[model samples]
Target chain A: MTRVFAPLACLAMALFAAAPAVVANAPAEATMGLVQRIFYYHVPSAMLMFVSAVVCGTASAAYLFRRSAAADRLASAAGELVVVFGLIVLATGPLWARKAWGVWWDWDARLTSSLLLWLMFAAYLLVRRYGGPGSEKLAGAMALFGMANVPFVYVSVNYWRTLHPKTSVIMTLEPGMRSAFWFCVSAFALLYALLLALRLRLEERRAEAEALFLALDE
Target chain B: MRVAWAILRKDAAVEMRSREIVYTTVFFAASCVLVFAFALVREGRAMPDAAAAILWIAVAFSGTLGLGRTFERERYTDTLRALMLAPSDRPAVYVGKLLGMLVLLAIVEAALLPLIALFFAAPITASPLWLAALLAAGTLGFASVGTLFAAMLVRARSRDVLLPVLLYPITIPVIIAGVRGTAAILQPVPDEAMARFWAALLVFFDVVFVTLSLWTFEPLMTEQ
Candidate 1:
């Protein structure tokens, strides 16, 4: 089934992301100790990345099993969102990495893998465009296989030496830090949900345009 | 079995006699080396790993060229449709076609490896056996994806331009795994540390592409 329409998700996410406590009480450098404030966008962008991949994987599996056009649309929608989330990761990652790691860029495993993943998904987008009528099937297959890298990007931090910090929110966070972090988390998640919703709409328009062109040809 | 074998043998025989892929691929790879060499003359330290990356890049580019050429040959002059109509399960055709492509790529890679070593002045010796295997696996991974996609692109507007667009993006992970694996092995480190990571990646990727390509080929072929 088609997911909820884009406008609705965007509206809901906007409201949720803008709760007063998140924006007004955000731990500014003046108030909260340093390194405590980047949490606002960092975790949210990351959460969105995972959410996008999960959606991509779900739609891909649906398409493979059923081969329905609806499934293809969902997969495409999710794939498009992955690209969006990827851009978020890319923009926000370096900012945080530089602060956390003291360098603008490094060959840290997470950074490299994340960069590779962005390229991989970017490649996914290209593969779909390069594919012709029969490309949907190929795109579906790629979505599934490429999803493997999503987790690799996550766990890759642990695999090798990295400047990116280990996952520490759960293991050790003062309650105050946790509250601010959660605010950032909810805000970014809402932002992601909104963007994802809008992207899926664009995909529908593009798909509809393709169908129209094909019909006119006949 | 005989029917499939016939297709494989015919393909091999043609490649053997024409030597088109080998000649074109070797020339193309050498040209890449020379061009990149002149460009990176100041950065001589770019070395063999860089050479390896360039080597594989040329190999992938040339392999796609060959694949597109092969499909074009089938589309314009040969009997690809007739072969499909032949009494063979299509997966057999997939297997046979993939095998032929693999053999052709292997020949190109074998020739290119030492050249890469010589250019970079790095040893592509027996120590990097796993690295060599990783390169081979990565080639297969790209070939599998390219061969199937090339088949699809044959009917498109610009198959040659379109092939790399589709082929390389999907193959990025393979490139990462391949380059990383090769670099890891060539780093002169103990096998146990990074070996599992690269080997597992190569094996996992190889399995993924081979199986996915096989599964997708029938639908892609039937669509045309």
Candidate 2:
């Protein structure tokens, strides 16, 4: 536990330390003003959400084919991370939207797709928790489908061309803002790795306990 | 192909004898339209604008109900176990189920079209052939994914609820295409190009999901 917490604590500290630089050094957007600052946390959280979903999907594919406890555990952990970061995106998104778009919620393609992706994995976790005996395999299948939807979700913006900003907008940020963004991205990526490792350890311990229980029962 | 036909014939014969699923789904579709009419009438909204969206929502939900009951019948008869245990090609079984679902949903949609037309007083601007093509493509994509997920959910508890929760998120694109295509056909000035685009999207979704479902069905149904 200490081993896991020690590194996570350090990352948390670094994130806090970097938070000020992100706010102070990064130039505010000409349009959205102070609210644009949320972009740092919001974008990184969304990025990690996508990364976690991909990991979940790959690990799910692995579990589906091989039926390994390790793969299932990693997939399960990553699935939870998708929800975690997805919530951050979901929350920060509306706050930014309220400022930028003047509506707390818009049925824009990107926002709707993100919510759908989040719900898809939320359902995945539900199945794992309550689906009884073969839940792992069920959840694995869901993960694969969720992963498959990601590209479609990412592109739905182009397909519909609604209000949400396109990918090119991200590429056009000023250098300092761009670097600040990358720094936050790195910090959140580190956070995701730390959480995944800690979650996987918890899952392994639970598996060991269940195995011991079965042995004792026999 | 022969194996698929035999299963399809067997299910068709059984359905003909009982007509249980057909009646229930058709009734469900009607009820959905009625409920929507009542709800929307109270709100004094543009029912024509909502007509296409309402029709697809009814079909999607009722179709989900049919899929669950179809497998539940297999479970009651222990036929799922028998079929899984049998020495036969599994993808054939999937094809057979997919065919059965397609036929069933088509019937429900057939019943739904006139009801929507009457209730919303919306003119069907596109030709019948074009509308039928869009419906077929959309339902094909929907049932392909529905069949796979329903089969996977067969033994799980709360599968009735799980089916939709699991099914809807993945099938959103199909729903979007279906609604957009239907709207195009029902539009005041029908946009042939837009309708064709949505139809093409539906076809693309059907091809990808059907192929994936067939490849994965055997493994997913297997007890690991």
In terms of DockQ, the best-performing candidate is 2
Candidates' TM-scores? 0.81, 0.95
Which 10 residues in a row give candidate 2 chain B its minimum summed lDDT? B41-50
Query: Residue A4 of candidate 2: its Cα lDDT?
Result: 68
- Interface RMSD for candidates 1 onward, in order: 3.5, 1.3
Candidate 1 ranges with C-alpha deviation above 4 Å: A1-36, A127-132, A151-160, A188-218, B1-4, B41-48, B126-132, B184-197
Error of 1 at B216 (Å): 3.0
Please give the clash total of every predicted structure, in order. 0, 0
Candidate 2 error regions (>4 Å):
A1-5, A153-157, B42-45
Q: Pick by lDDT: which candidate is best?
A: 2
lDDT of 1 by residue, A122-191 (tens): 7567667765556676666666666755554444334546666667754566666567667667666666
lDDT for A51 (candidate 1): 73
